[model samples]
Target: MDDGNVSLDRMRTFVRVAQRGSLSAAARELGIGQSTVTRHINELEEALGVSLLGRTTRRVTLTEEGSQYHANCLQILRLVEQATEEARDARRVPVGVVRVSCTSALGVMHLARIIFAFQDEHPDIRIDLNLTDERIDLAREGVDVALRLGPVMDDAMKLVAIGASGRRLAGSRDYLASRGRPARPAELTNHNSIVMSNVAGSEHLLLSAPDGTRLMVPVSGTLRVDHGLAARAALAAGRGIAPAHLWLIQDLLDAGKLETVLDEYDLDAVPVSLLVVPERAGIARVRLLVDFLVDEIRKLPGITPHRSASG
Candidate 1:
């Protein structure tokens, strides 16, 4: 059997038959006659010089080799379908649903607006936005693109560095007034603090000083929160001081409800990144949204733009 005789049509027919477990069922699914399905399978086996299917009068089953071949065929067919869609989309207007994910806080505060604006521009494009703080599997969850905050540990996904999300120590004006503002980082221990339980190190704060000095200040608080919106509410209600991503509290700061504490000190900036599924990266709609998101994200206040890099 010559390997050159193997064809995608044969592989697809084999996969369908393997999945359906019957030649008749596979033929029906493929809109072909059962005889055609039988011929395709026979051709595949003859070309490969291996018996792929265990045929029976009632049902069919895959041999060990067939199972491996089926898995590979699934991947190949998916890639081919994707490539076809991308090519077709390139010739037409960018139109389709693009699934997007973002941290809840950022989504509510900024990304929602960006997405809405994008939909307005590309009226044919629709967005399915998933908002959560939990790190999720993009491929498993069917997310086309995601705005990820902090370190993106997965080097598998294509990552574009949007910028560093600068954080600031801040509290409500009322809280600062009632408790008295801490003049230094160490003095934060005396104040009632609002801790973000979702962050890695909630018990301690690492701050950089104007003099290029860095210090790790241990902190404790009565109010421990996981969600950024909850922490923002606690801050607005004058619960306590907490380190916040500037975008998180920018509205309150503008409204004079919150004030930056220890302006001379800085917290380590979190990396703001856009993650794209490698397969979806070529789709016209996905590419449009990704480019739009990156452009708009750069304009966000408190986010420092840097050279974009892919991992």
Candidate 2:
């Protein structure tokens, strides 16, 4: 090995040159002189006592040893970078546009409240929320953070399960009075069920009978909407009985407009998750938002029991 002094900058030059396949292109990318890039690569190769690059008029090529050395260099550099990023303030809590993606229902129903609360904690940050019912590709969409209902299948992003909400049957006192109170889960089949359309395609609801026989009923109604808020409103209007998030109907229920049905049956719970691409979540503005939102979600009335406790 040629005993020569090498710096991080020279290693960077070598990597850049190898990537571009030419010193001129690497120099252009680095905004440095071509001669300087060549010097740095030469110096790095001399220091390692290995031929890192074979220079030609047309392009640069790597030898067998150079290929292995390049991989090691990249890994080492990445490790050092990650450590540096952790030590530095990722600048996560300041004011900036954080692009957030979520389903239209959640973004419209719950995201606004959380965003307001998060903004109160971080006044500088501005949230750009994109609402969609369809699945969005985070990388293609260029979203910084996303609030999702239920589990995420993609492992490319990190997921934090903030909390969950369950579907509950609700209807107005008038609607119940008009249709008559259902005596059992089997009775639901005879009544009008305000099914949420997106969920109707699947069998997510559980129904149990008087004889202790559990039946999973795939329900339907004349009135079905995608949004939870709309379903709650429809129920309050005595339009039809609907399945909804309990928190969304609390005020309506409190006002005696809506009543819960089939409480005895075991219903499936929907998970709320925070999906963040590493680049943004690792930064300050996004980090603060994720943390704040998680805290608020935990305190949500639907998920938490209302009891005497210390703050």
Candidate 3:
């Protein structure tokens, strides 16, 4: 086979199709017609002398060789694009689209402010911040950076130690004052624990004492909520006692609207992390944004974020 027979477009089509899992999906994401995408894939497979995809009625998956090729292609393609972009931006400051994702609480409570500040400084950088509790695929989801809590399993990408955000059993000022503060972890069982179950519903809680003791408490409530904002409201409204991230409840706690319970047990605050993708690992723009986020998140009153402990 002639090396010249393989075009970059064909390689790109293979990668995109692998990521999206179907020809139609690739076409949608690449903004090309399905026929064009299929043609590219067929051409690439013929050139390489191997079947790249195993297509079924419902979906498409890569063959064993295709999987390896897909991974290699991703690394190579990203590096090529990164180099080109770096050369173009060498004279200019770091500026371009930066897609960031974060959990709901921090996204609203902390990340939004930092992104606004980053935008103010880098006027040319278009920021896309996706706030969700769902785990994100940085490559597949097109995320550049993620302001995340807890641990990240992947070793390849970089995680900048943000700050510590241990959870605490807390309730609204009205709830605590009216219901009386929980003197012990076991006392949580006695309270009207509002469980933040999704619409489908389930009750769970990871509660702790100030002394570093922990307990996983099964909770039931008059309301089972899913959304963090709604849960916060439910907590604030004295709907019931629930565990909350330190950052999310900071203002309310300070305002004396919410009070922490079980001060004796040491509760593991979810380790705050800035999940940076490999593509942006060394990019000045990404580096700048990650640093700026780390700085800003630390300034968040009452939240403790730190490097996640390796398990």
Candidate 4:
């Protein structure tokens, strides 16, 4: 028997036999005939010139030599599998589906455009966009990446901080015209505001001045809503003033439907981040999409890009 005759198949069969301790059981596990398993074991032993197994009518046990060889075989098989996967990943094309999760308002108002542009660039890559505000389990829901606002609490996820999303005090032109723009942050108390009930401390407004002065002003509203789109609609309807993310209302501001009130006062910014599943982060399509999203998101009007953060 030649050393070259020790094939991977034979080693696998031998390992299976060593694990199962029965030729018939190994055959069943390998989806092969018992004779085939026997031949592999015999050939493996013959090639090595060692009695690898002690056999009886009921069961087979690994010899000391077999025990050592089984350990080596396991290591070799694992290495082979890892190498194969690495090679495949290295050569994989930027194709296939990338499942993305984002908040509803951001998805509809901004992210949807970015996604459409991405698809146009990578015609082969398909997108499954899940627009929801819920913090979903990425692994359980099979999400490749998630774009979220605020802090991402999942330590298991790989995070890429796109930026801090800046907000401004804004209201529709008609509303500001009727109610009058607040000349100072304190004057906001006299104006009707559209508050986002979902945000923490929505009842109060925090503003920072260029002179390093911070003000905490209590705010009240006739209409308090939980979603961005609703707040936007109310603002467009000349409802009241509210702190709005720049990306959410940039178009309205451009069209003169909305105007920034108290532009000198800056509102607190929220962290915008991309959370990727650790396993999927290595895939060609997912990586490409994530990179594209980061670049695009950084270009948004009120985004202040930050140093990358990963876990």
Candidate 5:
């Protein structure tokens, strides 16, 4: 078939009809009349010289050749759409709805503020922020970007390192005064520990000494919480010592509301990263949001921006 004879609109219509199983349903989704939908399918079949759909009064079914063509059509349509979006994005004015997913603690403590500030700067872009601790399937959920702590779990995602957040053992001033500070990591067993259930390895505190020696101390507490914010609140209220992100509790630590414990040991930094769906990575809004986050998140207290290994 000549390239000029094939229509992108017809391909889209056929794919939609294949998915919806009815011309009326595809027409409704496309905001076109049923007659136009039928015309598109007929034109598409004529161009390809094959019947793409077996139509019945009840539903539409694909023939064997139609099934193969449908798959190819879906990929072709996606590429065309992506190309169009890329052309539009070349203008550099990010103008679209970007859906973002992040943990509740990070969203409430820092991400929310950053998003609002970003929205103010780019008034044309709309942000839909979903805050939850549950792990989300970005593709399934239609999330453009995700801000996550620790390592990127999905290898399929494009990972951009935002920064490094180090956790430090902290306790309220009153709690420290009443319970007495532990002279060594081994002594932590005696004090009440505010365990964060959400954090991995919360049951044990990993401490490293100045000489590069590491110690894994078993910890238990009366108060255990699943959320990071709740755990921080408990630690700040003189409950017990817990490993808290420096960015989250820096203000309290500076104000003497909380004091750092076992200062001699250097704790490793947990990498904070932004995950973008591979297909969405080329979108202007997603790229802009990622760069914005990389710049702004580094500005937060105690957050060290991650550098590439070559850098």
Candidate 6:
């Protein structure tokens, strides 16, 4: 038998016979006839030009060369099985760690709940959520996904616009009663505003009229904070009126703790998007998680699905 003519089936049968110590027993385990098992072992021995087994009337034992070959065969077979399982898991199951980055306020107020629900549905996938106010390099940090407000700035990333949320001029009921409610956009300057120091253009409140007219009003306040959650806390404590994302304050509005002012002048809707490395978009778990987030975010109060994100 030539080396090129060696068969995997024959090698497997020989290993089984060596382990079982009897050709007939290996044949029974393999559900094959005794003659077929004998022929396989004979063919393998012929190909290798060595006697693999010392066969007697009662039992079979491995020869000196056969012992080393049997160990190598076992390793090869185990590796093949592992490779097969990995291939199946990649497509058929969500099994792996997915690292995600998100803004601190969004993560605490909304994203965390969504992730918890997602984990409940997919028990095999593990999520590591890193919440921060400062932006970080996703590739360097090994982050799998990121949820961010506004448009995708990195051209290298694959961007999917998940939804849109609008900022509203809001004040707590007690604050409004104490300071008097602003009947129009112009009156906001008279009332003290709790400004978010980290947000761009937080000092100006931009309002749009029904006929598409826009106004940029200068805003001032006694309290300034670095995070949105802190600003929200100040507002809830009746510190002053401030521009707030409706999604973040919907419960407050419902409970009458906060109320929107100048409802006639609507604020522009800001896009919320999911960002991922373009190459990772093809991964099964990444794709599934993106879809799940988009679906859930659209259902949030004051959030509307982006046209491109709508299926």
Better-scoring candidate (TM-score), 5 or 6: 5
lDDT of 5 by residue, 2-81 (tens): 45546788878888788778999999979999999998888778888888899999899899889888877766765776
Model 4: per-residue Cα lDDT over 1-311, one tens digit each: 68875988898888789877899999997999999998888888989999999999999998999988887886675456445545656776566678899999999988999999999989988898999978887764557799999988999899888889999889998888888879998898999989888888989998998797999999997899989999999999999999999999999999999999888888888999999977677777778899999999988979988865331
Best by TM-score: 3
Instruction: Give the backbone clash total of model 4.
Output: 0
Give Cα-based local distance difference scores for all models: 0.87, 0.73, 0.76, 0.86, 0.85, 0.83
Q: Candidate 4 overall Cα lDDT vs. reference?
A: 0.86
- What is the lDDT ranking, best to worst? 1, 4, 5, 6, 3, 2
> Tens digit of lDDT per residue, candidate 6, span 1-311?
58763666877788789777999999997899999999888888888999999999999999999988887776565455446545756678866767799999888999999999999999888898999878876754556789988766898788888778877888999999998999888888898998888888989988889999999999998999998889888888999998788878888899999988888888888888889866567666777788898888778878888776554
Please give the range of 10 consecutive residues that has the lowest summed lDDT in model 4: 77-86
How well is each residue in 1-311 modelled by candidate 2, as lDDT tens digits? 54554777886777777766888988997899999997888778778888888878899988888878776666565556545545555443365567788877566767788898888877877887888877776754556788777667979898777667766777889989988987677677777877777764542457554566767765667876877667767888898766677657777778787888878764556777778977556766768788777777666546642123122
> In candidate 2, which residue ranges exceed 4 Å CA deviation?
1-93, 200-204, 208-213, 304-311
Of the two candidates 2 and 6, the one with more favorable lDDT, higher being better, is: 6
Ranked candidates (TM-score, high to low): 3, 1, 5, 6, 4, 2
lDDT measured at residue 125 in model 5 versus the true structure, 0 to 100: 85
Report lDDT (Cα) of residue 190, candidate 3. 76
lDDT of 3 by residue, 187-207 (tens): 677789877665232365554
Stretches of model 5 off by over 4 angstroms after superposition? 1-81, 309-311
- What residue runs in model 6 are displaced by over 4 Å at the alpha carbon? 1-91
Clashing pairs in model 4?
A: none
Superposition TM-score, candidate 5 onto the true structure:
0.74
- Cα shift from native, residue 72, model 6 (Å): 35
Residue 251, model 4, lDDT: 90
**What TM-score against the true fold does each predicted structure earn?**
0.75, 0.65, 0.79, 0.70, 0.74, 0.71
Instruction: Please say which candidate is ahead in lDDT: 3 or 5.
Output: 5
Clashing residue pair totals per candidate (backbone < 3 A): 0, 6, 18, 0, 0, 0
lDDT for residue 2 in candidate 4, whole number 0-100: 81
For model 6, what is the error of residue 275's alpha carbon versus the real structure, in angstroms, after optimal superposition? 0.2
Q: Give the TM-score of candidate 1.
A: 0.75
